[model samples]
Target: MREHNRTIAHPGTREEQMANQQGNQAQGATKKRRTFLGYLALMGPAFVVGAWQFGPGNLTTAVQAGSRFDYTLVWVIAVSTILMIFFTDMSVRLGISTPTSLITSIKGHLGKWIGVLAGFGVFGITLMFSVGNAVGSGLGLSLIFGGSPVLWTVVCTAAVGFVLAFRNVYGIVEKALLVIVVLMGLAFIASTVVAQPDWYRAMSGMVPSLPPGSEILIVALVGTNFSINAAFYTSYGVKEHRRTRSDYRDITLVDTIPGIVAPGIMTVLVIMVAAAVLGKTGAEAGTIGALASVFTPLAGPTGAMVFALGLSGAAFSSMIANATAGGTMISDALGRGAKAGSPTARIFTGVILAFGLAVTLTFQASPVGLIVIAQSLTVLIAPLLGVLIVIMANKTSLMGDLRNKWWQNLFGAIGLIAIIASSIRLITTLLG
Candidate 1:
């Protein structure tokens, strides 16, 4: 009776072990599910950066690359993308470690003037990007709805302003961009499917080569694709999302790698489709309208409309991200505030929109020219931005354990070299 009572009181040790194991299994499953949901929640910042990076300028350049040079330049996009991921990753770490905005952190670590200059420099690049966004948005809408391009530009600008005017501006902008990127992704994927590019040749294009007269085009491709400024703004998005160190690994897996790579893949698809559809004919799709027309002949009116919608999505999404980034950064630079919804940031955003609109209206004759010039000009400021990101990420005191790994600095060095080389080429091109 005593032995039986003791057995009942304790159960068997094996039974207790079995029960604990089952409980742990259930807990592990729940923890994994929670972790997965956390990843979904962290998806915003990088996509926003991606949307900003793959704008009208990116589209125009990719189209030009495919149509004019065929697959020879695909390697440029490949290299730019790999380097971009490194720079953006560095920015992500900085965002998580720095106490305040990236610019503020720069002020703390680098110097007040350097931070201020970085802000203005980024703002300047955004101004150039805004020109492409304004023109592309106008042209894209006109292609879809059959309206005056200028009228659509104004409407789009006002619409963006309205979106920014809301409370929780960063949150609103992030969500809006997410939707745009999804739509753009679908449209491009479908377009690529219908266009039916040559698989073997497109794969071969992965090898880098410089076809004659491709220097300037290559510069434009690197400028738009590598896009150090877009990478720089990523930290702001990270800070806005309030990501912590615990969130870093998950964020990289779910957000940073995929987010940056998504656009790179889309850009590649665009190049392949263009090469298949237009390269053989030796026809150059220099402008957005010209690019859209190429799809119509290949896939009918529906295809054309699909491509136009993608363009509109790209332009509008970029407009929002670009202006918001510029405004927020500049405001932070001037000691206003870093948050997107801050009064000064909103006002500065409006100013950016207004500047783009005014420029588009005045220089309406050459939208494509504006895009190339604007994109090329960004390289002038890009080397500086790239250096700053690498420097900030390497600061042990500032970044703690999140500081850049050695491989990161190595890639960061390569990116700086690429940007500096592009800057030199662009200057020579301008001079020549």
Candidate 2:
């Protein structure tokens, strides 16, 4: 055969070149779709973590703050929410970088007893707080459907039990929470608009001030919004999602923004509505009934209904998340898996849910008191957890390149100081 030289055109014939271009476009589109879905999956855990703050406990506290002090305490929500973003970011980093649960990490670095104590504290906090969720759910149902709060509590408990029992419970929970969050946003935003708050006062409220006797309300606001258990749960939630170290980059931090911001916005709306209606009238909202009344002046009967719906959504979503946090933490503490759908997780979740139901039915405690008490108690335990997380995040061995930078450490320290101060104040208030 004669020697031959051949040169291949980049894409061969024009038809072949067009086909190749089409194929490339198709691949690009597929890649974009995959990335979009990955982002959505990453959002699941953070959204759940954020939605946890919108519970009935928070609702009660925000209502009290708004009704009692108008926008005077809105600064607390802003400050607490900013701290939430920092802590939650640390959680995401921990979850993506570490191979074990936060408790296990603490045990490895700190004393075993310290880790054990922290675990127990988280469980206790979750258990006590679950009561607020149950009561809040029941109160919401009673407000909307006109039933016994106790009866509605049992029904809501059962519904949560059914969801937790599912094999794909985390998926169900994320979707459920996302829907509930949307419902809450709509309800609160609509109510806020209807109330037509004085924008001047609302804006000025962003400036920090200590109204007389407002210390307790400020603690409640901070404690509920910047929850320690929710922060710890963020680690497990990220673990449940099975994100790799590569996912721990800035994108991870970005994903948490919506989760943090949504609940803050909801809290603000609730407060604005309360300030407009209840504060203007100097009416008290120490009870769920009174809270609902604040909404009535905003949109009449429909406003009450909307408020109840938002409250129900917050209660139910928080119920699921609170149980999951308790179950996941307790299960991890016992050396079982922390995955949301594990047998141990489900069992522990049911136990917490049952306990909450029993308490709500037996005591019939005031919803506001229940929330304030549960949230205040967290102050004692959360600082320990926050300190541990900050310490862990600073460990180069654990976090490698993703460890807390100087600014992160500075903010973390500030947050810790604020938390400790609030906790001391809470204890003092309780003691006096």
- Identify the candidate with maximal TM-score: 1
Q: Give lDDT tens digits, candidate 2, residues 249-359.
A: 534545688888889989988888888887556677765568787666556889889888889999999999989888888877777876778888788889999989988
Can you list the residue pairs that collide in candidate 2? none
Off by over 4 Å in 1: 1-35, 279-283, 367-373
* TM-scores of the candidates in the order shown: 0.90, 0.89
The residue pairs found clashing in candidate 1 are none
Q: Model 2 misses residue 349 by how many Å? A: 0.6
lDDT of 1 by residue, 1-432 (tens): 998887676446434434533443344343243366667888988888899988888998898898888888999999998998899889988887776788987876678899999999888888778988998899999999997999999999999999999999999998899889999999999888878888899989999899999998998889888989989988998888877666677789888998899899989988987887774445677666887887777778888899899899999999999999999999999989998988999898999999899999998887667665665558667888899999988876566567788888899998999999989989887778
Candidate 2 TM-score, true structure as reference = 0.89
Which residue runs does candidate 2 get wrong by more than 4 Å? 1-34, 250-254, 279-282, 365-376
Q: How many clashes show up in model 1?
A: 0
